[model samples]
Structure formats: structure tokens, C-alpha cells
Target: MVISRRGLLQAGIGWLPWRAMPRLTMQLDWHLNAQFAGLCVAESLGYYRRAGLVVNLKAAEPAMDVVQTVVAQPQTLGCAEESLILTAQSEGIDIVAIAAMLQASPLALMSLPQQSLTHPRQLIGKRIGVHSDGRKAVELVLYSHNIDPQQLDLVDIPYDKKYQRLSQGEFDAVQCYALDEPIEFAQRSGQVPTVLPLKDYGFDAYSQVIFAPTSLVMDQPQNIQHFLSATFAGWRWAIEHPSTTANLLVEQYVEPDYQNIAYQQASLEILADYVLPKDAPRLGIIDARRWHESAKQLQQAGLIAALPPMAMSVNDNLWP
Candidate 1:
């Protein structure tokens, strides 16, 4: 008998039975951008279905409230910045990071060629654009380099407008994912925006964490493990065969955009440095020390009131 992904998940996680195992839904934090290329690969490659998960990939609205949405649907899992998870947990939301979809923070500051802002400290006195969700990451980066947020003016700009605004000189720089906007802008204008990576500045935080309610994890540990294991395998595969994965993304998910395929392939190569660290356990391994350090940095930057104990937020069973 061929067992379905859901059946295996139910068996592994000790769900009541195949009939009792409910379908799982996931909420992503953004549009179908390259940052989520692995998810696209997983979906196209049959990873989610093989794991018995029925994922509903929703379009994220500008005003979407991530915490409220997750709280309302207790069984639903939501992906967002790790700082948001810490913020939610600090507010007693009971969310735990089950798997880290992105092992490194993608947040960075991008500047036009004329500005030549090569370092975080140089961002002082410049008009910076950042999404409200990205404020904590930017603050952490600034704090790590001893740059005072008060010295700089922050403009709350929608992510879509960031590159254009920068091109038009609306802001001196914009905080965005190194993997997406900078590449997109460069492709469109043939001018590569200078990027200052936050991780390089010691404000290391996890981006794109896969999180669900604490009760859900406690009740279905094995299911969570299976989901993460397959998900990690999907990422590893995506990284190994980026062109093929990008082709899958363009073909299966939507009409082929050859430009996007090229962009995604490049982004995947750059992401390899972030996702797979040498001497670490392996790809997608969630480190407790890294989590604690990130939480502490957020606290120090005043993004969170307090750091939740590392034991409370990170679950290591997802790592192979």
C-alpha cells in the first residue's frame, strides 16, 4: 500500500488516524518572490503534498496583521521575521519557531551608485526607507555599528516602491532583502545597487522562520518533524539545482519569465553562503545559540521588551 504524505505525517506525529488528521494551512509574509523560491520548488516538487500537508499560499496585503491572523486561526502556521515571533511570544502569543526556512537574515541597506554608502555607519544623516516589519532588523544593524537611529530619518515606504523611490532619489537608501530588490533593480536598470548586509554587521537574525502555535507543536511533534524534514530536503534540492528549480518556479507556478529564472538562479548562488554555513550541523539546522543571540540583539535594540529564553523558542528536532 502506498501511503500518502499526510498518512505518513499522521503516523509519525501520532495523530488520531488518517481521517482525524486535519489539513494544514500556511500563511506567507509576502508575494511569490525569489526569497520564497524554495517553497515554490517544494510545492512543484511535491514535497508538501508528500508530507500530507494541504498548504494554502495566501497573498499578503500591505496591511495584513500577521499575529492577529495566526491567533484567530490557532491551527494555522505563519511565516514571518524572527523578531516578530519574539515580539509575539513576548506578548504571550505562544508561537514557537518550528523550522527556520531562511537560516540567515536577508535584510540589507541598498544605495544608489552616486551615494556610495558602503558601511552602516555611513547611513547616518541619510533618509532611509524601510517597511515597518523591517524596522527591528535595521535598528539592530544600526545599533551594532553604534549608529543612532535618532540621527537618521526613517520613511515608512511600501516595499514595491523602494527601488523606484531610491532611483528617483526619494530616499538616500532603502532597507530590503539582498536577494530580491537589489537584483530586480539591477536587472531593470543595469545598475547594481550597493548593499550593506546586516549579518555582515553583526546584527545576525533569522529571517523567514516557519512558526506555529505552541499547542500545535506539542500535540503534533512528529508531524512537524516530517514537514520540516521534507521542507529542508526541498531547499537542499533547490540550492543544488537552482536553474532547474527556477525553471520549475516559472513553469509550474506561473508562466515562464526567463528574466526571473536568471534572477532566481543568481539569488540562489548568493543565498548558498547564507543558508549553508561550513562547520555547522547541516543546511536548515536551527541553532539555539544563534536564536538566543538574535533575541538578545533585538532586546538590546529595543525591538523586544525582553528576550525569551532560548529553550522556549527553538525546536531542534527539525534539524537532520
Candidate 2:
């Protein structure tokens, strides 16, 4: 009697199966920002192929809700700020941060030099034009200086119009990234925006964390390892050869503007300083104390209902 396909599979139960392997598609949050440029570089440079992953680095649009997207597509791994992941976790989302692209936060408050607002306390009673989602940065700065959020008047400002609003005296300061608006403002307008870095103000949250559902981590730990290893190697190469990396970004990832190339290169160097500390063992190692401290501050500021226990938030296994 001829054995049916199912019977043949059962007959050779101890042998290897011939099922087709499933393809994985990871959905990251954004495009070629300084933090994500390394990922793009890795893809273009074939580092992911070397690591046995077929990564498709798609750009996330502004309207896309990453958390919802990740939840909807079980096969896709999502990446974004660690705080966002923490917030999702607090709300019972099953996502976990796998690796950090930036060991330190890059968020900052940018102001005109003429404003001369050197301290956080100086922000009190000022009309601050911050992106609506910048409450965290504002709260962190206020808490660091023992100022109440109620003291400052927060006006919602669109990011594209921030420079114009500040120039027109519509707002005293704007929440921005050290790499983007500050560099653009300085280059185009010859006005150096003073940056009050979040780290210096006791808000040491990690930025650009690699995240995926907890189920994915449990089922495919090797895939996570391979993705991070290649990604980190790409970062190492970018940090060491910023000019070449910037050129790659301009040619492959962005419009070929000479000024944009210069801006991106300088921004990448600054980001490198933040990603790999001089004394740190590896590039993406999370500082637990800093993580806890940031959570505590966020808790005190009433940002989240309660801080998740430290154990659930950070993974020490990510270290090289």
C-alpha cells in the first residue's frame, strides 16, 4: 500500500521535515534619522545578509501608529523610543525592548541665543512652543529644577514652523532634537540655538530602542541576536567613519544636498558620543540605574500611573 503524504511524514517522524521556512518582516518606526541611519547602512552594506536575516527597512509615515501596527502584524518587529515601549507595557502591551540604538536620550530644548535662558527655572511663566508630545521633555526639565509644570504656559507648535515661530517671537523656546533643528537653524540662519540637553537635567531615558512582542523574543531569540549584532556593527562602522557613512546616507537614503550631508555627518558624530560612552563596555548597554531614575522621575511627574519594576524594563542580556 502507498503511504499518503501525512503517513510518510509520520513514518519519518524522526527525520527532518521539508516545510518552507517563514519569512519575517520587521517594521521600524522611522527613516534615516541619525539613530536609524546605521540600520539603513547595515541593510545597504549587506551586514544583515551576513547575519542570516532578510530585513526590509521600511519608512514609517507620520500617521502610522507603531504600537497598533506591531499588534496587528504579529510577524513584524517595531522600534521606537524606549519610553514609548515602557508606556505601552504599562498599558498591558506585550512588547519588550530588545536592543537600544541610543544609550542616551537626544531630546533637547532649543532656544535663541538672544533669549539667554541658561537655566530650567528661567522657563517659568514663559510661552514655550513644544510639540504636543514633548510633555516628557518639559516635565523632566521642570522636575530637575524643582519647577512645576503649571508654572509654564505650553503652546502647541508644529515642528516645521518651530524655527519661524521662534524667530517671530511667538514662543520663548522649542523642544527639538540636538541633531535636527539646531543644526539647520545654525547653518541656514546663522543663529546658534542653545540646547538644554535632557541628560544634563536628570532625564536619562534611552532613545531608539529595538522592540518586538514578548512572544517573538521567546520564539525567535536567535533572530533578535542576529539583527542586533549586524545593526550594532553597522553603528560601529558609522561612528568610526562618519564622512563615508554620511555620504552613504545622502546618496542612498536622502536627497543629495551638500549642506544636508554636512549636517547629517556632524549630527551622526554627536549621536555617536551619546550612543557609546567613553567608559561603557559596549555601544547599546543600558544603564539600569539611569533607567530606574528616569522612570522614577516620570512617575513623580505623573506621566505614568506607576513605574514598572526595573526587572521587567531592562534586559542585561543585550550587552556584547
Candidate 3:
């Protein structure tokens, strides 16, 4: 059957005889792009169907709060950075991270060549545009460099239009996906930007961390297990076949600013570095140490009321 958005949303790819399988939905935290290559490949290639699941991929809308969006429908798993997930859990949300696709979050600060922003310390005296949601993460980068948050000028910028503003000289820098934005920013504006990934600093946290309601984890363990196994397998395949997965992403799940196939491939290759880093234990494996470290940092930054329990933040046993 032809897998259109109609079919994928209304039903599964090959769901006629498998109609009774567990139906699930994933609420993405941002627009669909190569960043979600694994899930895109998994859904388009019917990996979910083969694993007895009917999954719908929901692309994020502007101002969409992924945590509350999924919480409203507990059956829907959400993909977001672990920092936001930790904040939610600290505030009494019952979400548990099941798997981390990105061992290092690609969030970073980008600057024009003239600014010559070579290191985190260079950000101290300049005005950087930051979204409200990313303020904490950016602050952590500053603090890690022994620089005070107030030492730099951080003006709130719209996430969608940051590149436009940055290119227009509205600010010295903007928070962006180091892998995704620098490509398009360079292509469109014709000026290569300096991308400083947060991980290059001490702000280590997992991204694309998939989490579900803790109750859902306890209730539908098998269904969750099937989803994770197939999803990670899809990731391994995507990492190995970056070009193929990039094609799928460009064709099926492309965003307005991310239409170029070459750009998508570049983004996917950069994503592979984060997903399967040299020292990574394995793709899609959540590290207990990272979760703990992220939670503590979030607490220290006053982003969360207190550090949430490890069990509440991650389900380390569901990696199979």
C-alpha cells in the first residue's frame, strides 16, 4: 500500500490484518527532519508494523510543549532533550526516559565569522539570542566555562526565525542545532557560521530522549519493549545507511528549511557522530551517569525544584 500521511496517520503502513496491535503515537519536540531519521525510517519502512505496533509520528507545532502534550495523552511517548524531561519529572510528572538516541545534544550557540566567537568564554561580552526554553542549557554552558550568565547579553529570540535574525545582525549569536542550522545558514546566507556544540563544553546531556508516562511503562512493558528494540534497530540501520535514510527524510518528512538532499545527508552524518560517538557503548543506550549529571546541573541552575530520582527519569532496563 502507498504510505501517505493519510494512511500513516489514520492507520499503519500494513495494518489491515494487524489492526489489533498496540496503537501508539510519538509527539516530536520539533519539526520533522533528518534529526529524526531513525523514527522516520522505522515508520516509513514498516519496522513498527513488523514489530506489532501502529505508530503515528506527530511533528511539532510552534510553541508546542512536548512534555505536557504527551502527558495529556499518556499513551503518547514524547521525544525531547533530557533536561526538559528532568524538569517535568521534578515537578511531579511521571515520565520516564526509555532510550536516548543522541548521546550528546546538538544544542549550541552559532555566530558569524566576523564575531570570531572561538570559545565559550568569548560569549561573555556579546549579545546572544536564546529561546526561553534554551536559556537554562545555554546558561549551563556559560557556567561550565567559569563565566557568569549575567556576564553575557542573552536576548530572547524566536527559535524559528533565529537564523534570519542572526544573519541580519540582530544579535551576536543564537542558540541552534549545531548540525542542522550551520548547514542551511551557510547555504542561504553565504557565510559560514561558527558552531560551538554544548557538549564541547561541560553541558553533557542526551537528546531525542524518548520517554513515556511511568504508569504506561509499568502497564505496557512489552509494547514499550517492542517499540524500543525496533526503534534502535532502525537507528543502527539509519547510521549505517545515512544516504538512504537522508533520502527518505527529504522525501517523506522534510521541513521548509531542510529540503535539500545534500544538506540532509550532511545533517545525518553529523547526527551519526552524536548517536554513535567513538566511545559510545552502543546506539540508543541511556547512560545512568549522564542522566544523573544532567539532573544535578538542572537543579544547580534552579531550572528544577530538585533533582528527580534516577528511576523516575530513566528506564535503563528497557533498552532491548
In terms of lDDT, which candidate is strongest? 3
lDDT of each: 0.73, 0.70, 0.80
The TM-score between candidate 2 and the true structure equals 0.85
| Model 1 per-residue lDDT tens digits across residues 1-320 | 11244544456543244445455667778766556666776667767666666555664677787866876785677788888888888777777776677778888889998897888879889999988778888888888888889989987787666677899999998887887778878887788889888878886777788888778878766566666666677778888888887777666553343346787778778777666766556665667778888888788778889777563433344444
Q: What is the C-alpha RMSD of each candidate to the true structure, in Å?
A: 4.4, 7.8, 6.1
Residue pairs clashing in model 1 are 5-50, 5-51, 5-52, 6-52
Superposed Cα deviation of residue 43, candidate 2 (Å): 0.6
Stretches of candidate 2 exceeding 4 Å from the true structure: 1-26, 255-259, 309-320
Structural similarity to truth (TM-score) of each candidate = 0.87, 0.85, 0.90
lDDT of 3 by residue, 211-241 (tens): 9888888787666766776787788889899
Query: Scored by Cα lDDT, where does model 3 land?
Result: 0.80
For candidate 2, write residues 78-143 as lDDT tens digits.
777666766777677887766677877777788899996667888899988776445666776787
Task: Report the poorest 10 consecutive residues by lDDT, candidate 3.
Answer: 1-10
RMSD of 2: 7.8
Clash pairs of candidate 2? none
